[model samples]
Target: MKTTLSTTFGLLMLSAAVMASATEMPVVKPLRGTVESVSNNTLTFTNRAGAQQTIGLTDKTGFVEVSKADIDSIKADSFVGSAAIPQADGSLKALEVTVFESSLKGSGEGHYGWQNADGSTGTMTNGTVGKLSKANGRTLTVNYKGGEKQLVVPDDVPIAYVEPGKKDALIKGAKIVAFPAGDGKNARGVAIGKDGFQPPM
Candidate 1:
């Protein structure tokens, strides 16, 4: 993917800013930070840990914005993942559910901390949709790499999808994550989650 982080967003400049840790990582590692500045095809951002860095982009660079979606939009047999809170009766209630792109199947396929908005530690799992039950609440049977979990889908829970966007959307203070190709400093951004919503793992 080609990407060009432009210089200019609020006070962030892509061309005239900082860069750090040119170290190596796996094929595609997560690179997230706050927009400090941006220049055409390049941008400097400050990570959650307060480190500022610059990343390069090109025309093929992917730009997506994570926007809310409805639970009813989920389809059967679709590969999906959810951050859920365990219910009292051994059921899991989702805090966020994401219908993943096919290419992302098997990625982050296990359970992990959900960090629910309500403060309880929720569990996140990626799986295939089995069935949907509207009986008690909307319940979904989702299967993953090795196991399945019955999840309750609440209409109000926040679910998101990546949508196309322009560089203007990459404004200062916007939370963004750049998907690094092979070089640690230059890569294409797959998506940018708005308002600091956690990017789907």
Candidate 2:
């Protein structure tokens, strides 16, 4: 009886540990697309590859709006996040850039791997803007914790700003970048487009 009780306790402890670890894992952003329809708790959208996807939204699913911005919206010391493709000259050519609101400073602060909508790999760098110049196009230095990067923004790249949004923003034709739960059928949060601007990241 003593050995059996010890085994049961050990099993319970292991199960609890596994559950805790699973709960702490980071949410994945695997769904990026434009919303086609939205029901009470479920939404259908078209992915970048032109496939339709339907996902459920929990009550806790959050939303934010990305509004159009221009290069003039960025300034020295502005906090920003840019997803860029690495150029042969060791600089980054931006695919899209976002000037984050003051309240969102330090959100996802890092230089890390990113996967583009076309399935190509890229890098996302979130940092403070430094030494911005537009002599040729738009070039700026991004300073993060450990290092800095110089990014070249082309004329056609999307530039935007993020702000709090309402659920009504998830209407038809809305483009979004949504973070999904582990199951991949439910959304944890989404950054949706507003005022004709798409959420590029």
Candidate 3:
């Protein structure tokens, strides 16, 4: 009887251990905020309400920093932001970020038209060219033909318009259009049109 009781107790203990091990682990959500401070292996960000939080840097994280080359890429008043993604080797990596500034406001020397998805066309002799400077923050100004206009581009606008001189090197005259990639997200890319502009660099 004693041997049987001991065996039963051992089985119960093993069952309890298995149940405990089956418990779910906690989930970690993505963190979002403005960078407050940056260090070699960590970054501190302030939330919308001004609360500060720090996150440890990891291989899967991304980073962006200001550089002289980046400054010359956009208009004078444009603001820039960067992002870092983590790499598989446990190091921080840089993610591409857009810079926003005012749009190029001016009259089109040649006629330009906006073709709606429904196959309707609208002409803008005084067409404005604007780009979303950063991920989704503000606008950057570009000179079209002659005037100044504000273009409210959405966030996630891909590298649509390259600098004039660099156009040949990037996309050989790609026109900007909304390329919606499901889930309510829209991306800006060169469209298939008469001009046959190239894709962004």
Candidate 4:
């Protein structure tokens, strides 16, 4: 009787552990893609790998539009995200820069690794713009939580602005960076292109 009871307890504990893990939510990575079509609250798109994928969108799904911007759009106190490559002098040079809307001030508020459009790896820094200088090129001092980075935006670097968008903006050929839900097949939010502008970040 003692042996049987011990075995039963162990089985129950194992079953409970399995159940707990099964209910745990998944960590989802963002998906970058171009919209091919949208219908019935579903989005069909081609990802960076050129594979067709679909994600379901509900009424609660959020959308933000990215529009063409230039160096003139960035100013002191503006919140921005820049994808940059490090230079020999230790300062970073901007590959692309995004002027984030007020609501997105603290989004991705740190310096970390980012993948560029050309399949090269760089760093992404999202923070508040501090000072602006144009001595050589456009240099922006960006301040984040623990540190700050000085980024140089050259003449040819692409720039874009992010703003609130509606479902109508999700038309064909729009580029997007989608945040997936825990299931990985439903969209929580997306930053989609406005007009022909692709989301640089």
- Model 1, 74-103: lDDT tens digits are 778776677676889987887777765544
Better of 1 and 2 by TM-score: 2
* lDDT ranking from best candidate downward: 4, 2, 1, 3
Candidate 4, residue 84: the lDDT equals 89
lDDT of candidates 1 onward, in order: 0.60, 0.72, 0.29, 0.74
lDDT agreement of model 4 with the native: 0.74
Runs of candidate 2 with Cα error greater than 4 angstroms are 1-30
State every prediction's TM-score relative to the real structure: 0.56, 0.77, 0.23, 0.76
For residue 159, give model 4's deviation from the true position in Å: 0.8
Best by lDDT: 4
- lDDT string for model 2 (99-197, tens) is 977766665565666667777767777788989997666899999888899999887888899765667888999998876655567775677888656
Pairwise TM-score winner, candidates 1 and 4 = 4
lDDT string, candidate 3, 72-113, tens digits: 354443432222233355322222223422222121121223
For candidate 3, what's the RMSD?
Answer: 26.1
Angstrom error at residue 64, model 2: 1.1
